[model samples]
Target chain A: MTGNVRLTQVARRWDAIIIGSGAGGGVVAWSLAFQGMEVLVIERGHHVPFSPPDRDHLRNHRLTQYGHNVGPSLDDRRGMTTGDDPTSATWHSPLEWQYNNNAMGVGGGTSVYGAQAWRFKPEDFRMASIYGVPEGSSLADWPISYADLEPHYIEMERELGVAGGRGGTQTWPMPPTAPTVKGQRLAAAAGRLGWDTQAVPLAVNSVPYNDRPACVNCQHCVGFACPVDAKNGSQNTFLPRAMETGNVTLITDAQVVHIESAGEKVTGVRVVQRGKSMVIPTDRVIVAAGAIETARLLLVSQIGNQNDQVGRNLQGHYYASAAGITPESVYDGVGPGPSVATTRWSHGNDGIIGGGMLADDFVLLPIIYAKRALPPHAPTWGDEWKNFVRDNYRRTLQVMGPIQDIPSPTSRVLVSPTETDAVGMPRVVLSGTAHPESVRAQTFLLGKAKQWLAEAGAEQIWGSPSGQYLSAGQHQAGTCRMGEDPRTSVVDPSGKIHGYANIWVADTSVHVTNGGFNPFLTAMATAIRTSSLIS
Target chain B: MPIDAHLVPILRAATARIVPTDDLPGAAELRATEFILGFPEYADSYNAGLAKLPADFDLSTPDAQDSALSQLSSDDPHFFDLLRRQTIEAVLAQPSALWDAMGFVVTA
Candidate 1:
């Protein structure tokens, strides 16, 4: 991490070029710039302007069947493979299913994220050690321990202006939003079920912070940009801090197609800007595109492939849900939903190596509610479906979260030899599903959610069906996993690729496990910790 | 949504079966078929999937329609699932007198 170049190379020329201005890259850019180092952040998506269209229930980021609110139109598809056979299926499949979950914009996923900020438990850092690595599962321990990341986690929470503390305490920077009516009922129900239901820390402004107004209960919270600027995404937090430093230049709509590297070093990146190809030279490069894209980029670059572990061990949460017909109307219609959560099952479930935190679900948009919420095999059409929804939309409560995934080397991202992107870079091929134990844990946790909902006055309860499709989507992680051993990992504990001097990864891509909770806060914390050691 | 002139009957029958008029106003009353037909983005898939049944297959009665839907779903889960989802969505998306009838209320 040592290179003292002349100021001539620092004029809008990046000292450190970060690809993808999402949570991880955002923190990294701001951290470097705060240290007075010139940094250039490149984002492949637009700086989406928040407008009324963002409130479109059917077309927003959460429900993309009709259209996408994040700018990549339905036609803007990416190449990917299916199942475990990269050679079987081509990239012509729908992007919604195959490209893995990613929001294309300056804020990246943070723009429309539900903002569930969470820290992985101590056991999450040592999966294989706590419970021996099961055969056929590529699960292993993280190089860095949770103790090593504790300070950074707190730092990330304070910097991002999160709201929440244990048992709804207001000890943090901002008081947690009063648990929604849904939250209260769920908390009581979880308590009755003997689960530790508590307030969740959210990367949302509960009170005015940094001059942004508090949440207005905008119903379109999860997949839409905050109209009042109450949500503290990387766009509102680190991106501005980086910009205000006067040492960072954020270039949006600049898609990097290649990382030009020669003999154990990355020289610069080849980007397509405004339909023009340009090269930005830099001594340091941090690829935080995403778990999927970062792995794809590394594999495409043909560097960081010493052990061929670049795109292996791709992991994401096996998200499962349980919904109940609450006797009372729990539909508060507040913007961000399911503020109450129980981490009791996050660990110590019998015979289960991993577990997930169960929380009330987000404020379901009308269309999203129609798509989900209801029990399985509920009528898809007709009097039964319509009457059920009409009767239950207000009476429904969903409890769900991401289940920790066991990594599998076979389920991975690879360079597609045939399918190429618009820039001629070979597209990513991905396949795999959650390990059987993770699925078993999902079912176990789902029962708890069902019981909690039932205790909370739900006369009838239903569990969301589980799927075996490669679970990697929005909570995608571990593609370019971090470990002390270079043979098994792409990046080291410092996030630098093994044996590489300046090339590093700081996003969920470096996650050893996706964790029971949301992974965004951990990704930001990793960025904070990694940037502190960059120089 | 502008109704597909030729596919109107099938769409209406399908929508009726999916959300048939019961004690309440149903799919036809809500114009679910017209709305779903207007969505060209996924209408082709639905049109192609529904076209599998005989042109004159009986869809007038609930039992017959339900049987057809079950068979279609069994034969091609993706198409039937898509059809079911889209039809229900069309019914639920727009303003319907049903909300008032069902005692449904949107809260703040």
Candidate 2:
């Protein structure tokens, strides 16, 4: 185990082999190791430590190009075309797609997420119970209820050092020492508007907890590494702790190709590392690659093909924002994530047709913000535009909302026949559209944002134009949904894949419905629950 | 003291509009222009670009200020853009108390 052992050398079987190192796999590895079970964790991304002494900010930014820094230019991987018409871009070509927000590293999406850890409201788990599914919607109730996962949410909050007050005036188990000033401002604004805005419960530390340092307010938390180890990503919390157990082994840079199964049971997994492909035996296996890749992995492996539920029901949230030039400066470079949030639109009430949360804009550097500017009735370049940037670069503020997408059976991830990745795996083909309800939600939130800016004393407000092609945000969920019925679901209540006792899924893919709030907290909670069940 | 030699008056105007004078000193006293101009990330290109300016032009005067900005604006919009952008960024990058005076929270 100590040397650079190939898969051939490590032919001995293991108790468990986890396919990801994010929230789900990290939790399972820790729990199994604690139970004295041998666990081997395979992560496709590298283990990047926080603020390495010789860290080149430029190089790191390049590696993480989907973020604000100059990096490998990302092509939209969403709309892949199938036919070989000369004009059509290949379905697998990375060059054709638009913007990609998903992060690919050891911590998965959690490493660069905004860390808005919100639990799915009680109504979310029972979607069929509350709102009857409309025609053309694949909505259904989750196998497990929020009540069943409540304690696990609490456990996740405690373990991840989530800082916020609790729901409905109920006190948090561990209260934050002090709310960030941005959170305070948002709370004040929400109070004035008569909307229930709460301090966003974040999986980031306000004070040193569980051996991690307190947040230093670098104002670069979202989409960037915490120079100080305060954010509760898997790398910062679970994975390292799991390694300390001595019962768990982590193999980085190992890309799993497929599961080598005998009939129904997975005997081992075939993986490629450094130009060699080999199989490592295991008694059980878990796939936690994430919503998009998890489904792609299953389709590639040809496992769970009977029901064809593995890669269906793709869902992701769409974000819309309205910004304006205020008479005053609202740019205070402190923490980087959204600190305050309003759940007024979280339910389809108040004349709003869909669900969402209104929150302040994440902190943006001037260069980043300039690129995002879209002034009404102005050319993208020229003297007027230069003047516009000069005049309003500092005097602008934004209010944004994330609209929840209704899961659709037709929207899915399929293997692209035309293209392949660096490792020869078929490229992931993503096909989906913004749900109509989600579009309506964006419209309502944009109007609300305009009103909020006016109330905040903005001189000239500019609302985003209504559009159909709303892109995905940090919230991507519900591909391999959970349900009591095996026909419609991929996993059971405890996240074990249907028809396979030892195969499990521990990622956002298991989300039955995309919750109104950020989904990271729910992911962590699910991980904790899955671990408890395995124990 | 006279305005810092590297500080453009337009930059001063933009910074004043962003965080106007109050109990706290404005961007001028903070030496924001000097900071942006001197930072290594921009120094080489900025110096070479600014070398095109006339040797004895008094940018403090309104006409000179307009002329200099217009010329710089046309040659490289990004440079002039950075001038306005960096001023606000420098002001926002200051301590939290300064930000609070300018109607902004330290976090969010």
User: Which candidate achieves the best lDDT against the true structure?
Assistant: 1
What is candidate 1's lDDT per residue for A1-535, written digit by digit as tens? 1122322333344679999989899999989998988888888887766653355666667776666677454544554455555556544433363345578788789988889888889999998998888878988999899999999998888989888855532256787776788888877777777777677778889888988888877666788888877888888889888888788877776778999988888889988765677777898999999898899888888878899798888887777688878776777677577588888888878898788888887777556777766777666665566777777888888888877888888778877777666667776777766678878888888887777877888888887547666776668888888888888988888889887788889799999888998999999999889999897
Tens digits of per-residue lDDT for model 2 on A472-522? 334567778887788998888888877876788888889988777778778
Off by over 4 Å in 1: A1-12, A71-85, A92-99, A168-170, B1-4, B9-34, B41-81, B94-108
Chain A (candidate 1) TM-score to true chain A? 0.94
Q: How many residue pairs clash (N, CA or C atoms closer than 3 angstroms) in each of the candidate models, in the order given?
A: 6, 3
Q: For candidate 2, what's the TM-score of chain A, rounded to 2 decimals?
A: 0.89
Candidate 2: give the clashing pairs: A76-A97, A76-A98, A182-B107
C-alpha lDDT of residue A425 in model 2: 75
Q: List TM-score per model, in order.
A: 0.90, 0.78
Off by over 4 Å in 2: A1-10, A52-99, A173-184, A348-353, A377-391, A470-473, B1-108
Candidate 1 on B1-108: residue-level lDDT in tens?
Answer: 243466668767877788777677777887777777677767667767778655665445667777777888888888888777777777666546665554433432
- In candidate 1, position B37 carries an lDDT of 68
